[model samples]
Target: MQISFEEFVTARGPALLRFAYLLCGDRYLAEDVLQEVLARAYRRWSRIGGAPEPYLRKAVLNQYLSWWRRKSSSEALVATVPDRVQAYRTADELAARDEIWTLLATLPRPQRAVLVLRYYLDLSDSEIAELLGYAVPTVRVYAFRALGRLRAALSGRAPTTEARSG
Candidate 1:
């Protein structure tokens, strides 16, 4: 059975916004991008009125990638600090996290997007590829390389036992 757009938005809005936040790492920009994607979805409602979940997610991902391409760098996206961060006993963890984020900013946009989607959002490779218009193996490769760089970036301060990715 089909649902109304209002109902669809009500169900998907928060999740979509969270995905945006994960990708852009900016709450404000995430909100803005979410609004923009929803507007586009609304405009193409008839064409994408069914199975809108993946459709909307793909739009959001494409919008983010497009915006990143136009921006010429991910520094503005990954270089900024999260609003609230944990205070560490040695301050080394915080410093390392900061440095990792900085190195993340230096990565190419697609790799950063892959890391954000795979680890940060905990999305499956096929789901990421579907959303980002990449091949499944490509997602795997990008995520693998991103994690390798991240491990190197925070080498000394690596989690003792393996904690969740932020």
Candidate 2:
């Protein structure tokens, strides 16, 4: 199944953006990665053939992770945050979600990526493994360990597994 680049972007743009945003903590970085991925995907769309999602996802994740690796967090840097940010749901939900993200950021980078892909993006172990180029069992282990850390972090808070299920 051959798809024109425009058609592919029109179809998968939103989902890819959402995935990108969830993968990277910042909207700016997410959008940047999305653009970079799409540009590369467009160049290789013919070779990608049908089912470009996995390829696009892998490319996006790889690009994002690479950027994270090259960054010097404490080194001199200048970037402006938006003056007006879009509001997340309600105040409480927003606060809870922010807390969860903060806890997530505390985990090791690989653990955090695995958990975000597994739970927030709702990718299965196999899917995450494919995207991350890891073994299925490795994905499962990272996700499990990440979940354990999150549980420990939020045990006293309002985000127990029971609440998550309900």
Highest TM-score, which number? Answer: 2
lDDT of 1 by residue, 1-166 (tens): 6777889999988998988877776777788778989897787787785689877877888888787667644444333555666554457877765676577766666888888877767889998888777899888877776676667656755432222232
Compared with the true structure, model 1 gives a TM-score of: 0.70
lDDT of each: 0.75, 0.75
lDDT for model 1, please: 0.75
lDDT at 86, model 1: 54
| Model 2 per-residue lDDT at 81 | 49
Tens-digit lDDT track of model 2 for 1-166:
5878898789998888887887776677789889988988877788997888877877878887776788644444233444765675677876797788677666666776787787777888888888788999877777777777678677765444532320
**Segments of candidate 2 deviating more than 4 angstroms:** 72-88, 156-166
The residue pairs found clashing in candidate 1 are none
Candidate 1 Cα misplacement greater than 4 A, ranges: 71-103, 156-166
lDDT of 1 at 12: 85
TM-score of each: 0.70, 0.76
Q: Name the 10 consecutive residues with the lowest summed lDDT in model 2.
A: 157-166
